[model samples]
Each structure stands twice: as C-alpha cells, then as structure tokens.
Target: MAASKIPGWVTAELFEDLLKANVEGFSKVKSFKADSGSAAGENYATIMLRVNIEVELQGKSRGRSSRIKSDFPPLDGKSKPVSYMVKLPHQLEMFQEMMKRTNIFDIERTMYNQVVPEIEAIYEEVGVDITFGARSYDLKNAKTDYVALEDLGVKGFKNANRLEGFDQAHTERVLQKLAQWHAASAVRVTTKGSYTDILLDGLYKEENRPMMTEMMKGIGSNFVKSCPTYEGYEVFIDKVKALQPVLIDKMFDFAKVDPMEFNVLNHGDSWSNNIMFQYDAFGKIKEVYLVDYQLPKYGTVAQDLLYFLISSTKLEDKLSKFDYYIKVYHENLVEHLKILKYSKPIPSLRDIHLALFKYGFFGYTVATGVMAAVLLDPTDTASFENFVGDTEAGLAFQMQLFNSPRFRKHIQVIMPWLLNRGALDM
Candidate 1:
C-alpha cells in the first residue's frame, strides 16, 4: 500500500523515534512498509496497520543508498526487521458516533496505560512472571486517538481459527492466563481500590441500552424467522419474540454483580478473535494472550468465563468439559490469590457454579447473537455495513449469518444446554 494511504499521524519521523525507544541500540530508521493489519470481517471499530521497518544501528555506516541490504550483521550495521500493529479510529460516521457513546478507544488506552500495568505490578511484587497483552507505545500524534503495539506475530503468537474454535489445549491455556489476570486484578482491588470509573458495565451500559436493544431485536427477529427450519427449535420462536423487547434489559440485569458474589475485572469480549495463542515446536500450546480490552469491565468473573466457554470453545468439548474447565480456572485463581496474598475470601468451585447459572442469560445472549457472528463463514464477506447500513444487501447478509449451517449446528446444541440450565428463563 502507498504511504499516502497510511494514517496521517504515522510518519517516518514518528517511526524512527518509536524504534529508537523500543529497540536496543537502535539509532536511525532507513525506510518502512505500511499495510493493513487485520483481515476483513475480523475487526470493525478500528483501522489496523501492520508496519515493518528497517533501521540502522547506532554505529551503522551512513553510506547506504538502496533500501534493500544484503548484510545480515555487518561490521557496523545490522538490519532489524521490526513490526508493529497500529490501531486508528475508523473513519465511518456511524462507527465514530458509536465510539463517542462507547468510549472504546479511551477504555483501551486506560487498559494499556494503567490497568494492565497495575495488575502486572502485582505479579512482579510476588515474583510471578506473566504477560497479559502486547507491549504498547506512546503515540506520536497526541491530538488524534491511536494505539501502537508491538506485533505479537513477530513472536510467533497467532490467533486460533475462529471458525474452528479452541481445542482443550488452547482452551486451557487461555483460561490459565485469564485466571491469573483475574487473580491479580482482585489483588489490585484489595490493595489499591475498585475500578468503578472507567470499567463500567460494558456493552450493557444504560447509555448504550437503546442501541443494544435495537440490535438485539433485529437479531431475535431474524432468528425467530429461521427457527421453523430447525426440527425441534420451532418452539423457541415465540419464546424469542416474547423476549425481543426486554432482552437487552434482561442482559443488563444478568451482567450486574450481586453483592455477595466474587468479582474481578472481566475481559468483556472474550471470543476466539480476542485471544492469541503461541505454540511450542512440538505443536503444543504454550502461552496465550488476551487482546482487545476495549470493553473490559469490573464485574463477576462469570461474565468472562461464560462468554468464552459459550462463544469460543469447540462445540463438542464445551458441554463435556464445562465443569472441568471451571475447575481448571478456579484452581489457577486460588493458587495465584494465595501467592499474591489476596486478603479477600477466595471463591470456591461451588460459588463459581452458582454464579454461572445466576449470570447464565449472558451466556444465552452469546449463544444466540455473538456466537453466530463468531461462527460466520469466513468466505462470506461480513462488514460493518451489514450491521448498521439499511441497504437490502446488508439486511440479507445479516440474516444469512443466522442461517449458517455451522451456526445452526451450534445453536441446536448450545440453546438446549442453556435452556436446560434455566438460562432462558425470564
């Protein structure tokens, strides 16, 4: 792509300065390449940039003419293949308006700038090594909003296939990281204080309720329309129609933390897309990182565990391993809380099981709406236009997602599981 197509805030001077700060012994940047970072339909809120740079060392001979260099580690100069993912606000008017209401960028900035650091510091004090996210850098253009992060791809961390979801190995790794992060956040709260100001009720906030309601109505109507095709699911049409008006309010209620419950900072959007896993040479999952903290909230841990289990894990493994997964998470949580010397009463496995049912409707919402999007056929071009635009094509695309075979198969299994567990109760 042309440099002109890149965000105006991303300049050669800015890149040189960023490299100097992040790279060891880095002096000057020669040239760079900028391109779109994310695939289509994966992300909608921000325009992602993948930037690769070739820089000169402190003592590099300033005699290079061509941009391409053959020297690996020459006497004075070394070629550095550095990459970064720069996120900029999407220019769409509707999305821009949504951002204004949601304050997603600001939330993410706080995650990188304050929340994660505070949580990581807790781990540091306890001498526990962990990484929750990519290293972020200070943006050059302080005026416009943007986030620049060290590319995890450079370190061999990649997202699992969203369509396939996570196997047991990958799923366990993500839960382990999440458990530690949650434990640290709990410690942070005990020592520092609650995170009430910024980590508000995430998509279910009162201010965004109207938008969410409208969106849910559209999804519910489409789902009801398609329920007739599924053999035993036709009974759900009226059930869903009855829920169309108050579903958003119900979800908001379910997301609320009960005074007696155990709460932590939830990775509000914990689908497969927001998680990255790194594998060892033997193809075994080694580490995982949770990304995209735009919607993180201070709430019951059930919110995250339910969302991830329902929306991201392999369908077959979901029901069978549900309790086992919860056990895994709670074990790690208890272990870390003890190590970090958390002063609060640690929640037991029974507490987690009870909380999951109490907040079970949140998982229902994920199964019906979010999971459809998650299981959408990648070959089908889904864009933000399909969500907000009033065009016929957009409407058709939206409906098509509900009718997807993969989604249909998942819903048949998950909806019953949720219904049997009283998640469908009003």
Candidate 2:
C-alpha cells in the first residue's frame, strides 16, 4: 500500500496512536492502505493492515482488528479491501459518554446489536445474506472515535433526492419491510421492560420541545401565507397553536401503551433517504437495506409507518395507493409477529391505520417545511434565500406545497378517511 497524502486534518501520530491503543500485535506491518473514495470525510479513512497475531482484546478475543471492517465491496469498482474508519474522540473534542446518551448513537448500537442479528437470522433461514454489513470496535481507551465495519458496496440513498417512476410493487415491498422492522421493535419492548424504558425516556425528552415548537411555528405560518383560498388555513393555524402544548404533553404518552402487546421495535427514522433500494439487473428494488439509526427509539408503530410514507413518498403517489399500502403493512406486521412467537395477536391493521390518521399530519407538516428550504430547485436557490429573508415570503414558500394540487388531493383522500374513523378531532 502506498503512503498517500494525508489530509491536514489527520496527523500521522494520531493514526499510529489509535492503532496501538486498540490492537495488541504491532511486531510486523505487512500492508496498509488509506481510503481515497470521495465519500471519505475529513477525519476518517478506511485502513487495511496485515499484522502478526498477538493476544487479542477481551471483548474481541475472536481475532478482530482494532477498527471496523466490512465485507461489502467499494463503490468505485476497485478491489475489495479490509477497511477501518478512525475517529479521534478526545482530539476532536467530542464527549464519548454524551454521544452514547444521544438518541442517534444509542439507536445505532441497538440496530447493530439487536435488529441486524435478528434480520440476519431471518435471511440465513431463507438462504440469503440480506444484511447490509456490520461494525467491529473496542471502546477501551481508544485514541479516536472511528468505527470500522463491513462495507455494503453501494452509495447511500441520500445521493438521490427524488426517485422517479417508483411502482406500486416496489412501494408495497418497502412498506412490508418497514412493517417487519416495527413489529420486531414492538416485540422487544414487550419482552424487555428495561430496554423499553430507556427507549421511551429518550424518545420524549423535554429538550426536544423547543426545536419542535420552532419548526411547527415556521411551518404553520408558511401554510397560511401559501394558500389564501385554503378553506382551513385559519383553522389549521389555530389547531397548530392549540396542539403545541398537547404535542409536548403527549410526546411520551405512547410509552404508557402496554408494551406486552402494543410495542414493536421501530426504525425510528424510516424515511426513504435512510433506506437503500438494492437493485437487480433490471434496476428495481430487489431488496432494501435500512440505514441511519440516528433516531431509533420505542414508539407507536404508526409513528414510523406514517412518517416514512409522508416524508419519503410524494403525497400524490401515496394517496393513490393509500388503502393498499396500509393493508400490506398491517398484513406483514401480523405475519412477522406470529412467526416471532408473540403470544398475543398483533392489532388489526385498521387500528393502526386509524392511528395513522391521528399522527400522519404531523409528518406532512414537518416535511413540507423542511422540503421548502432544502428541496428547492438548484436554480431557484437565490429565490429561496430571498424568500426566507422575508417573514411573509418564507411563509408563502412553506405553504406553497400545502396549496399545490399534490397536497390538496392528499388531504381530500386522508381527511375523509380520518372523518369516517372519528380521528379528525385529534
């Protein structure tokens, strides 16, 4: 391996120090390679090394490296290399303990340890390796906060902003997988009381209130200004204001639901961006790999299901298949729960579907506000910036989506469904 130019951000001493801190044998260094991929960030690199065997760390006695490695291939069609990502936690001024406490890292570890294994077992039973990859590391006195894991051999879904021509079958498959994911988490809560407690504590923390409130205010204001003809604009605004207190109060109420029957493990953030659509030769989603465990926490199954549909799919497309999509998700959830040996039958899909009406609007409201700022046409960046500068202009841009044909049709479809189910009050 060549000694490529190390970024100014990474020092040679830091690399050597981390290697020594995590692994034991350094008697012979056969080969070393630094990752040169564009996806490689400032502080981390994928390093491969061949070293003489020595005494292994306590937890990693199975002969693992000090860093993470992946079985997945590189995206650039290069040779598959043993890789490890290095992060200098102390030098980077990041608190490892505090990071551990955050919902992001906690959910990540949960997925890595709990969810992945279960999914792997299922895949193995079915005679396939549908798992994305895994990370291996030792936390004791590490010089950096880097993690090394098996690469998945593909770019992240974030690289694509909007997916075109997504068919109903693909949509159903994704929803079904999400159903399985939520079912697993719900079962975990039922069987593991302590795990559920930790998850709920993090999910409804008061610290999140201020940010949520700010976002709601910005979005509500945008909705009103965007559609002067919108019949419910004023009512929506009033409802939003009234709901702020409730939103804060009810953030943790879902935790009170009986975990024995109601809880399922959920991919806290199941948006399309967090899922990779592994394609076959025909370029369709042959399988999906869930990613980004940053927001994983215990909550109602509806929370994850509704959030993914509203945030990831176009409002119009979702409305078209709303009934079918909901049915598929519920059917899959029930099937997985029974297979996993849950004593109680899973709730009716209709119950979950009704619950979505109560919570579905939440994701739409937030997504519209965020997409306004982040998803504007690149050429219209200046217009967006200018619009954002004016309080009224910003509000108009934010509400534009709500007033669009795409959104109105969605509301028409969903509002009736909610009204019929008596969930309109919520």
Candidate 3:
C-alpha cells in the first residue's frame, strides 16, 4: 500500500493477522481486539490484541494478550496526515546509514538481548514486571522488514502539558533508569570481547563527515530563520557556519571512542518522547520503559543522563534539582553495577559531572530546538507563522523557542559548560 492509501480499519486487520501469525507459532488463529486511538498521524491506528497460545514455559501453560502498532497510510484522495506538512529531504537512507555508523543500533540490540534481561530478572525478583513482553515474528515473503511485538497496552505518555506536579519525581526515576541501562552495557563491553569489535567497526568514518556537516547546517539555518526571536539573521547564519565543523568533528571523535575503553553505552537519543512510563493504580509513577533504539551507541554514560534531564525537564527548573537528580542516577548506576558483579565499580560521580561539560550542549540544543516545538500548546500553532516568514507552523514553533525562558536558560548553561571544557575554543 502506498503511504497515502491505507485506512485505519485495514491497518487494524493487518496488525491482527500479523500478531496472530507470530504469537500463535503455527497454532490455530485466535481472537483479538483493536484499541481505539490513532498515534502520530491520522493514518495510523494503535491496537491491542489478546490471544490464546499453547506454549511450554517452566512446565506451565498460560494465555496472554498482547498489543501491537498498526500504522496505515492515508486514504487515497483524502487529506494527508499532519506529517506531510514538512517536506523531508529524499536523502533519508543516506542519513540513516550515517546514523548507523555511530553504532547505536548494535549497542541497543546487545543491551536488549543481554543487559535488560538481567535487570528484568531483578524486577521479577522484586515481583514487578517493569519490562514489556518480547517480540516474535516469522519471515514474511522472505523479507525481515516487518515484525510483530506483543503489545504492552500503552498508547503514549500523557500530553506534555498535562504532565505537572510529578516533574521532579519523574525526572529522578528516568535518571535512575538510564543509569541501569548504561551500567549494564558498561559491564557487557568490559566482560565480553564480541561487542567491543562491533563498537569499533561501527565508528564514524571520513566519508560521513561532509554529509554530517550538511545536515547540521541545513537544520540550523532552517531553524534560525524560521523563528523571530534572534535578531541579525546574517550573524546567526555565520554562527551556524562556524559551529558546523566543530560540532561535526566532535560527534565523529566521540563516535570513534571504543566502547570497551570508555565503559559506557549511550542512548543516542534519551529524550522524553523516546521513553514510556508505566503508572500504578493511583496514577503514581511505577516504572519507565526505554524505547526507540534508533540512536543507541557507545559513549560516556553521562551523555545519556544529561540528555534525558535536559530534554525532559524544563530548563528553568533544572538548575534547582540538577544536583539531586545526578546523585540519584549515580546511586542507581552503582547499585546495578554491583548486582551485575562488574569488576569495576561505578565511576566517580565527580568525574561524570565534570565530563558533562564536554557534551552537555547537545542536550540543551536538542531540547530547546526540538522538544520545545512539541511541548508548546497546539492552539498556539497559528501565531508561529508570525515568527518566521515562509515557514511551516512546526518549524516556526521550533524557532520561537529561542525566545522562551527555558531556551534562554539552556543557552546560559551550555555556554559556560562549553567554555569550561574548552569546546568553545575548538
């Protein structure tokens, strides 16, 4: 089906069939249900399916229900989804390849297969299934392009506007969660020789440098001009040009570091949108599930921790609680490392905090530039047009973030951090 012709109902059927085929494991097909909610775009529908399966696990049989995502294209001749508003460059494959060279995917799979299981075992020992169900699939037409995951009944996290009062607690929990993942990967790289090779092999190479430079330039130019907050368009353009090589060089340098040597596994993208939270009966925070492995790679553990904090929390509130949250993350890292029986204890908290100066701006820039757009009130979409001439509402919204207090504070923090690390001089 073309990306513009699939309907919600048809998508539901496709998911049901895919789920039944994979979960049944060649047994007779059973019944399932489709949840009512369209996620990301009008063309897609998220569904939940409950199935009866006969399988031997520890000498027992159990029937379980699963959830899966059913993404559909827009109906032919109908209005397209909101995603069509912004035109993406046709060079997506090249970009994906460049991203893969960072070794995030390999790191993610390693963590998913080896590290997370041990953490889940601990959760199970504590009598809580903080993790989601495993994904199962069969070859469909000799291509492994599509696979089915047992749904975890989660739609998405509550809207950002609705997330109030629990910000501090939620931030703390997320930090600890990131620490567990990072510490596990650290142990794996140190103990196993296999992942070390994958990490080294996936390092960014010279061929990707020009493309990386172009991508950053395009994004920065488009973003700066799209909003009205910053004065002197020419000056901003010059700044972007000057910073392009520096940022790209640093990213490549960071990517070249061996995972075993660094003893850290970075969640390349640790923003709030990539994390899913599970709540208790009273709507209290219970656990967090990290998702979207597209940018998992090996880097300083501080990178992920800082990224999550800077992306998820409001910048205005960050400074006040920053020390506490860092402590929580370090404590969790130490605990998980001990449980995994790693020979090396968690790195000194001081060293991690100091290292934040090196790459902290990444979090600030991404959060201010990207998250601000999504977090703004949707009703304010029309006003954004006034910010940037000839730009779409989404891009305009991102540009307007430069004037927000959160964005200002982010710049303030990042400037000093960069200077302290001598990144600014570079």
lDDT of the candidates, in the order given:
0.79, 0.49, 0.48
Per-residue lDDT of model 3, residues 1-426, tens digit only: 133323223233344344343332222223322332223211110111232222212111224333433222223332211100001111235434554455443444555555457546654654545563233333233221222333334233332321221287777777777777776667665666434444433335576577657545544565555434433333334444466547767666555554333457566666665566767778787667675443555666655766666556765566668777888888888877777777764577786776665555455355434445434433334232222223465455445555555444455564444444444444
Best by TM-score: 1
Ranking by TM-score: 1, 3, 2
Tell me how far the alpha carbon of residue 117 in candidate 3 is from the true structure, in angstroms, after superposition: 4.0
Model 3: CA > 4 A from native: 1-144, 154-166, 194-205, 222-241, 258-262, 364-423
lDDT per residue for candidate 1 within 1-426, as digits (tens), equals: 356768665766777666655565566777887898877667755778898887766554445443443322333446567788888786777677677777788889889888888888889997878889988788665456778887999889999998988889888888898999999988887888878676856666678877776655666767778777765785455666677778878887876767677889898889898898888999888888888888898889988898898888888898899999999999999999999998989999999999888888888778876687788876435767665455687668767877888888888877777778887777
Per-residue C-alpha lDDT of model 2 across residues 1-426, encoded as one tens digit per residue? 233433343433333443444334322223454443222111111222211212222332435453543233122322222334332222221233234445344445555766568655754554544454334444444333343333344232222343332357666877877776665555554564445344554545655555445435555555544544544444344444454446544444543445444555566666544565656677656666665554555556766766666555665576577677788888887877776666666688677866665555445443444333323333222232223333565455555545655455445454444344443244
Best by lDDT: 1
Per-model tally of clashing residue pairs: 0, 20, 2
The per-prediction CA RMSD against the true structure, in angstroms, equals: 4.2, 8.5, 9.3
Stretches > 4 Å off in candidate 1: 1-5, 60-77
Candidate 2 TM-score, true structure as reference: 0.64
- Worst lDDT window (10 residues) for model 2? 38-47
Q: Which runs of model 2 end up more than 4 angstroms from their true locations?
A: 1-103, 118-151, 154-166, 189-197, 210-220, 227-247, 250-261, 358-426
